[model samples]
Target chain A: MTRPAPLAAGISAAAAAGRRAPVLHAEALQLRFGAVAALRDVSLSVAENEIHAIIGPNGAGKSSLLNCLSGFYRPQSGRVYFDGEDITQLRPHRRAAAGLGRTFQGIQTYPSMTARENILTGFHNRMRTGVFGALVWWGRVRAEEEAFTAKAEEIIEFLELEELRHAVVGDLSYGLRKRVDLGRAMALEPRILIMDEPMAGMNPEEKGDLARFILDIRDANRIPVVLVEHDMEVVMDISDTVTVLDFGEVIAVGTPREVRENEAVIAAYLGTE
Target chain B: MLPTGVLFETYSAEAGLLKTARARVAVAALVLALLAAPLATGAYLQGVATHMFITLIAVYGLHVTVGMAGQINIAQSAFVGVGAFATARLSEFGLPFFIVVPVAALVTGAVSVVFALPAARVKGFYLALTTFAAQVLFPIIVLGLPTSWLGGLVGLAVEPLTVAGRPMNTPTHMYYFTLALTLIASYAAFNLHRSRFGRALKAVRDNDVAAEVMGIDVLRHKIMAFFVGSMFAGVAGSCMAWVLQFVTVESFTLFTSVWYLGMLIVGGAYSPIGAILGVAFITLVQEGLHELGTAILRSGAQEAGGAIFAATNIALGACILIALIFEPRGLAHRWQVLKTGLQLWPFPHR
Candidate 1:
């Protein structure tokens, strides 16, 4: 794929600054559920400020890979490195604290909470005030909460979700819920963001809007994104690199155009269809 | 447009103290009324009310376990038994009532932790069975063991409690004492629900997987809840022993645990109001049945009176079944629905 001129400039500048170490790296990750090996020998790396996409046919273990990275599943054998630290055995919230944020394919919004409150739950780890401080409504805790609230509001405005800030997540549409889920992950202010099928159930218009938002997030925060999505058009448009998986194995890895033309990628999709 | 009423509404939502201004006022008024109940009621009613107050403390403990923590316990009466026996034994040595009560509560809380061990590994019917075993074992161990402290099958007599050299042997004094303790216990339980630990417990109850994912230690919270709940039960047991001036194995039977569980279901498991309401309703019903039996016997229907007394359990069983089927959420939920309806009067949205 032909890289965008500005993105190529940014990449070369980062490379010049000695940004060779991957922000997140997974090596030979394997997971087994009973008789089925959900993932086998899966390896991937995400560079700083780049949009990396993982795409495959159905049952390619895309979700399983995301789960392992997010600390939901412990692989039988593998190591995950985040920010140059080995975080293979860290718990989910600990990983989140270490600047790793993730959103689920299925919406996991707390139904009883408003959009703003749901996002605030993501900021739980960042808030340093103890229980006593919260109970007394001390000055420092109030200031801290106010600061986080302002940040969350900025994220809401960026996502164009200000109108739905006070609305309960249960009452929102699927597309809106997806955006709210993204807002929640953003509240964590992670250095690396992992999105699992952000456009899975959105219409074409919604998909375009989310794609623009994703790009804006990358530009504004300079945070690398690891996206697992099936939308080929989106993958081609936004991704700096694309990896194709087939039955838990990485079959192809290159620029979007290169993967699109690979014989192995074509064969994997053809056999499934 | 600049924000005016919008800011006010947002402020109210963010306040997180009760839900509305009216609720604040209502809670304040209720507290005042409870403080004045002893002055208004007669002696016999005061005694009955004091008993109700004690039972409410026990019910509140069960509420923490079954309602908030989502753990079924049929062993609360066993903890009560431990507390009651502990109090009696201590009082026999001439220990003050205040000293005995707290000591009993702690001992019972510790015993509850023992019963809660199986809860870490089992749930639902299996957990209930473990508690049931504890309930049965309490009576057998107390009665079978030839211990002078427990007084064997007959039990021990308690010394009358006194405040500032004035003995509280009268029903009216005991009523105020029990009522004050009940208020403190209720306040503590309600405040806990709003605390971080309380929210963690509720999170564990609502969804253990999600709570664990959120980094809450589910096992630790569950066990802590059991300890707190049993501590409350211990207070009730100690108070009951003091009020009656006696302690016996029969008083803290397995049947008491079953009745406490029934009270939790009838009153509504999650609400503190439900705990008090359930206790009041169950106590009043039992008293009413006893009165009816007396009236029947006095009217020369001795045989029918015997049958009516025998059938009381059947009636209570039927009420529990019906309440479970029709109002599974309990009376507390019904009360909330009513309150919300009144607050948002002329608008039907909940």
Candidate 2:
């Protein structure tokens, strides 16, 4: 596979650390919207530095799972644990403050703000001062803002978005907007990055570029990723472990090679092979 | 990595008004012109200018609620009435005008938060109707109060505002005072546009769900916007009390709230300058129409002049509808288009 040797070594060390302490754990999660069961006892665990991809058919509840984890939706009968803390009832902002970052299925860029300003918002929770400090622009607030800017610059560089950084997010192309959205999430410096359909509407060339960027982020940051994607080839190529979901139930969970050859996954995709 | 010097230079690049040399010059010109208005204009014109500035202040309040937060509020004139009555009653206790003004604003701001309660659950047209109820109820409540504190329907007369031992009774003095306060308010509003609170308000306006997802307390920002907006309206009403030397139920009527909204629509909702421009334009137009009516009466076209005076509401209604249809964003957008067109002369791309 020609993975960087040093990166592979670092990944192993990170994996060991991750195994010692899992970052996010969900137990017996159940969510219902009126009569329909959106999620039913979907227990899942995400380790600190592992790339976990969640694959599913059209209504398999992948998004609902992500939403529950991020505090957008409160499950009726389950608890979510982050860094060994019970966070089932925490608000989204509190979750963001505690190092959980996510991007939406469609880009949610603040159209009025420039790309830099959009990314700066991701660092809102990290800012030390309240309204007074910001108004005066003094002391700790200045230091915090500078630190955030430096970190944002690093993310912009990593994403190769230097030219697009000054442009308003509303004016950017869809591919560029997606990259900016990812960059914003990275700016949060989250321990766990949850992406909803990160590769939904990209050309092949754009896909290749994004694939490289995703790999670099995972390798460099050692941050675990929970990706919900439709592209089987990209998921198969990059995901360390794959969980196949169908009809709101886990069809299989294993290494990519094992999941690919499973009769059930093939049948779910091809309709009775 | 880019060179340190180059990176620093790029990072320091200013956005908004601070970035543009032309905007700086324009601001300077505006300040100078405002400072000179009292010197150049006559007594009646100065009085009109003072009225215009006070109306501008109230419109700025509407700007915060409608323009920035995207919340519909038609009860701003009721808040203004609250401020006016509060200022009048407080001043009657022999308190200084300066103290009375701010206290009136704070009281009105608190009352505005009370009015904003329904904003948490309702929005758009329904919220507008709720505020409309406030506007309708305000005059009735003011008149129904048993105490003569609010002057009942007869209203109360306000003493002249004295500054530093000098009574500001003349039109020129009132003009200068109103102009100074208006300028300060405008500058503060402009500074707020670049503040985090301003961005939060805009975010909530654009999409409350996304704003919540981004960690913004949508309800808090919405209420804060209402408070700030109401404070400006209070200040304006207090100044109006000083200028008219009286406070009355008729002065801050439901019709006045509609006029303020029309001014904002005509001037530009998003631009602060639009608030001032809209007030000035509407005031001048109404005065000119009044003068024309007076001239026609003198020139033997008495019946036509009487008809025009009686049908002023029709004229105002038509003007508002036409402005909305033709220039939805108001005068500020038109001004922006013109400026941009000039800046990009011969290129023709916005």
Candidate 3:
């Protein structure tokens, strides 16, 4: 039995209407940096087509949880499972190869590269061309490159980045660069997309555009999104399942309205007010 | 760039190497002229052109390592020396220059990886020091090897290059051979920039953390840049050895490596054409000024001419700085700007 979707009036991702097996999950993760515990026994699961949102106050271990799940940080005692396979020991790029796509908290794009080239690099794990093969550029290599270029263009088209295709990302506005970062992650064609504060600093219009793109990605691409966001409005508007974290531990997990009313989450945010 | 009003429906057409009729015609003309110049030029000019070809290939390697991959390689000339020594030893086995060149490149590339192993882990000044260690070790290792191996103090003067069982020792022969290989090396470097390897390399260069999160193995791509860059230098070394009919460690010193980097900077590092333009521009300036100095020393106005020529030497030495001052991106970037102006004619600003 699942909670009612009283707030699921917007997006198409059902709130447990037809939930499948979890596509990505972190089980009992415990990460420590020296004496400080960044995450302790944190666990969460994301199913297909679900927009799973992780919301927390600053210093609440949201990044640590995302890092542990994305293979950037190894939990001292836990396991990460994707498609029912444990991938705890995998490195970041290795996990990426296994379809773990991620976007950083800031504008972490290839500054010197054009917007399109930046997105094309997101297809790194998908393609199989090596140094020699790429250097030689035979028929097969050219074909592979053209196909990647087309795929990258598709991402650019969806992001409405046709004009910025040739512009170097470093020269673009901050909002545009953030959008390019998202487009690049989309270019990975990840089964489950993990975004770290995809809208940390943005104008209202850019935030609306990115939110729309996120919904389009879920509806059209069928990729589940695990978003670590500070914006409560955007989180409540998009997320199907909400997990509230505080001080390196999960405090509450439920639907948006349920977590919004949860006494612990209220205390964590407002502190006995 | 396409014509002002032109548009392409396909990405392939938009990304074509020669997108315009003018570029195609220019490439054809340049090829025809290069093939025809050897016939019309004197032996001295041919010899100088052959030398420029060697420098071009070396600079191409630097462009990849320093330019695209953002790996600082001041010891590229050391890698070139490794290639030369390797080619000399390979030639003693009586293989043709064709088989020998590729093998020498691989040997040099592998040698570069030894340094790249440490270099790849570091960045900026530390990486420079790592490559510098390669340069510092090159002469010591070469000299420390048995005198019987590749001639410690004394260099190797192997057999001349052969084609159809005949020694091709003429300047024209050397020029044509170096020209062909230089073109091939250029093509390979160009293709590297166009394809996925280059994108990955640039990604690592611009931001390694971002690159890693994007599924690129940053360390591997950095090492790959060094390996491929050294291979180009190795091919250049092979060309240098066969053309000069000798191999000497002195020919590829740290000073020479610095010059190769200088050429890459002058040409612009990001593109293959920049390598060519940079190498040719610097070579012409140096050679032309040398010829003028020699002429002035023998002229009627000896004292004044000598003073003027000495000033000219300082000016010529400062030309690279001057070029950088005017066009910080290098001559290739200036060329791009000019072409963009051509594409956007009737409007001076872009």
| Chain A superposition TM-score, candidate 2 | 0.89
Please list the residue runs of candidate 2 whose C-alpha ends up more than 4 Å from where it truly belongs after superposition: A1-18, A127-158, A187-189, A219-221, B1-18, B93-98, B144-149, B310-315, B346-350
Model 1 segments more than 4 A misplaced: A1-20, A49-52, A91-102, A105-227, A233-241, A254-258, B1-21, B85-106, B140-160, B164-166, B347-350
Regarding TM-score, does 1 or 3 come out ahead?
Answer: 3
The ten-residue window of minimal lDDT in model 1 chain B covers B1-10
Question: Number of the top candidate by lDDT?
Answer: 3
Interface RMSD of candidate number 3: 1.1
Q: Estimate each model's TM-score.
A: 0.80, 0.88, 0.93
- Tens-digit per-residue lDDT, A185-245, candidate 2: 8867788888889898999988999889888888899988889999999999999878787
Model 1 chain A scores worst on lDDT over the 10 consecutive residues at A1-10
Residue by residue across A191-259, what tens digits does model 1's lDDT show?
Answer: 988998999889999999999989998999999999999988999999998988888888887889899
lDDT of 2 by residue, B126-238 (tens): 88888898888888988999656688878988877889878888999998888887886786576555455666677677667656666667777788878888888998988
lDDT of each: 0.79, 0.78, 0.86
RMSD value for candidate 2 = 5.6
